[model samples]
Target: MADPTLSRRHLFQASAGLAAALLPARAQAKARLGDDGLYTEDWYVDSFLDLPEDFAAARGKGRGFALQWSQRGCIYCKELHTAYFADPAIETPIREAFDIVHLDLFGAREVTFLDGARLTEKALGQRERIRATPTFQFFAEVDGKPKEVARMPGLLPRPEFSALFRYVAEGAYAREPFDAWLGKQGKG
Candidate 1:
């Protein structure tokens, strides 16, 4: 009794409308950037590696968060931000798992170290030989001194980075090299 042709057309239109409605949400979900805007001055990136003076003095309070020092106008740095940190695949775990401090690698802002010495982020980077932009340092306090346990430069693929994070979070550095541990993770 009904008009089949008109009914099919109407059905197609409804389906198309539903797909259109979901388009924006799907795009947004894929590009879920943090409010930080990828390391612009608007928001500070987190560096969980830095330890407070008192914490450093204790020397063995277990591992804390890592530190990330970055500056504006660096291409590789921006890539690291957008391709790695900003990606929802990585950001959520990092936020939940560590304490992060964002340092302006070029700004005049001052940071006090574990030894009670203070310096600008640029100076600290220089001392640490971070000639490369976006150096990720895994830090720990040993014998009342700040120590860098691992230094990874540039952008890493999500899976590799996630494995490295897992290794560090588990304190595997206490007994083995990160690369060796990473090999083990990849096998499984």
Candidate 2:
């Protein structure tokens, strides 16, 4: 008296469940190694290297715009993609609130600046005075155009990193210094 169709449905469901169970419990990739030899996050913005357009798109999403400057063979860059971002408490808010564009500190790919200057990534790095890998350039709209507002020269440990991102999100730089704000938040 058992319905064959019902039995088949249960078998299929069980098969699917078993397949899932057979897979690795921690199958998620922490980071991807790009062709450029840099490690990157899955959530980083993909773009045409147009700074103005990228900024506009990020603004449209109601998110902050940031440029992540890194280089090939940079150990700190690897840690940024792996360890720092692995912390949900650190990554969640920042990932949700910012549109991060990754750039190579020493790359040949062309990038168009907000000022309409088209240059290679290496040139842009020089123009921006970038002397270190894993620098973060935070931009804000000023006079109806994207302008760099904050620059973090290198990586910070978890709490400070979290606080820095929060500081940018809160627009706290206009009101006070980062150290002062960090102290106020009890994270300095």
Candidate 3:
């Protein structure tokens, strides 16, 4: 017994509005370009450039930890934000699975590395061999200590990118390479 005055279109609009209201406020908003000339989402981790501490915090939250290396004037980095991250299907799960600390690949911001060495972000990037913009270096507990477990050196297509997050968060890397894991999932 539907109300004759309440048309399906009105009902649909009401439902959509309710859904939007129920979502986290930030979830409905788009990613923003920061003053540093990088695009940042509300969900990205706000860190103090202490790599080891940040990793511990991420682990405390039952999440993976990663460094997102990007430079100011990189087009691929922009696309990673504007295109891939703009889609909730790709961004939501990533937001859920990891605490991402953004770093400038060429900036002089001081960062404390896991080995207790404090160095500029640029120097650390060089030490880690992060030569390009938009590299993701994921870390996890390895042999009872925090160590880099996997790395994505550049932007990946949406599907593979999402799968890469899963590969780390689910501890699938210890079982197999990403390609083999993806192949088993029928997305390779």
Candidate 4:
């Protein structure tokens, strides 16, 4: 007869070995932290926090302005960077279609609105009624001013996020609401 103790020991050892083998992969799935303890990416556009100028610049580059509002210690932001933005399929379209700028939800950095209003990043978020981290504000030029065309208030799944890039890039927001457009594309 087989020894029950030996069988249990073998099972435990195998489970431990499998977990050890998966450690690197689990680590790799985590987002890399910046000096400020927030996730960072090299391709995000560096700007002077001027919305009008940034919008014009993005248009000049054939892209829209994407303001990403985040806060430190936001797990959703980390997931957005690590899981969604890290995917080449999603990142490539976003990089091609939008000039992304990061804004801290509670930071004191100065920001100039398109209407010539100046406020701190935190104040701006308050003025905009942004109550959540990882909010994405997409803008397009409307009559020489940067107008907010769409807003994603929270983290979207990978497919929806990718579809968002496509919808904006294709100028579908001008014709219909994002939900309608998304539904038309069978991605809603």
Candidate 5:
């Protein structure tokens, strides 16, 4: 006759091993940092930090401009890049619809705002009153000025995030609030 205690211990050990095996992929999926100590991605648009030019280029391609603000040591930013943005469902639509530009929240790199104001990334963040990492500012050209159509101040779940890209891509921001549009889609 087998000891019940021993059998239970074995079962527990197996379950623990299985859980441990599943943890690595997610735990190890930390975003890769560049030499500048910023997370790097090939998909991010390499720009001269000229917002007007970037907006025009994106419009020329029939897309909108997406500015993604991140900072070093921001876990939310890391999670967004590693988990949410990495999702195929989210990446596909964003790649197709927006010219995504990455901005370091505290970076010293010079940027020319759409209104022709020159400032460093840090100054721009200050001017924009960005209080969170991973803030997304979406823009559309209106009357020759790049107007902010929508702004997301923090990380959104995959469904909402994907919907955001579609919302901007479809020019729905001009007609309705994101929450209203999301509600119509039964996501609210």
Candidate 6:
């Protein structure tokens, strides 16, 4: 109807203007890590978050649950948290199973464990070869030692991720390799 080129140009200009307006907001959301190398508030969303202190007594005494690593600037991690961890569909199982700790892969803060050893988040990330954002590593309590049993890198669609979390939480990894266990469940 009206001039098509003119309409297309106007659309492009509007889209560019919107992108410009969003730039500052995105930057603000990705504020620099503090001197400690962690977000000022690593707490999960809302008032339901648990304190790491609650897991203090279990340190080194037994094989306890630990989530691998995270960084604030990672969009996939944000979506993973928002879409999976925060969703009621999966949050209940995670809360019941693991003592979740949000670690900044590049942060310099001291991470105090239940056993009382302190290390930086960067050190831990390096130990895990964390080359990607939003990696989920599972640990098994074998003879009271925490052994890395399985890991998932990147944001997985819910059903598979949920199944993996459940498998670990239920101690099914104790019986077999995660892939084999997943295969048994028809999800491998």
Best to worst by TM-score, what's the order?
3, 2, 5, 4, 1, 6
lDDT by residue for model 3 (47-70), tens: 888888988999999999998999
- Give the C-alpha lDDT of model 6: 0.62
How would you encode candidate 4's per-residue C-alpha lDDT over 1-188 as one tens digit per residue? 86656677798999999999996654355456877777866778778998778878889988878889999999999989888866766776787778988889898889998778999999999998888879998888777667888888888888887887788778888899988888888544
Please state every model's RMSD to the true fold in angstroms.
9.0, 3.9, 5.4, 11.1, 10.8, 12.7
The predicted structure with the larger TM-score, 2 or 3, is 3
Error of 4 at 69 (Å): 0.3
* Worst lDDT 10-window in candidate 4: 23-32
- Total backbone collisions for each predicted model: 11, 0, 0, 0, 0, 2
User: What TM-score number comes out for model 1?
Assistant: 0.65
Q: Where does candidate 5 have its weakest 10-residue lDDT segment?
A: 23-32
C-alpha lDDT of all candidate models, in order = 0.61, 0.87, 0.88, 0.82, 0.84, 0.62
Give each model a TM-score.
Answer: 0.65, 0.84, 0.85, 0.80, 0.80, 0.62
Task: Give the Cα error of residue 154 in candidate 4, in Å.
Answer: 0.5
- Candidates by lDDT, descending order: 3, 2, 5, 4, 6, 1
Checking candidate 4 for backbone clashes, the offending pairs are none
**Candidate 5 to truth, TM:** 0.80
Residue-level lDDT of model 2, residues 52-124, one tens digit each, is 9999999998899999999999999989888888767677799899999999998999999888999999999
lDDT of 5 at 60: 92
Clashing pairs in model 6, backbone N/Cα/C closer than 3 A: 36-109, 37-108
Top of the candidates by TM-score: 3
Instruction: Give the clash total for candidate 5.
Output: 0
Candidate 2 residue 160 C-alpha distance from true site, Å = 0.8
lDDT over C-alpha atoms for residue 97 of model 4: 78
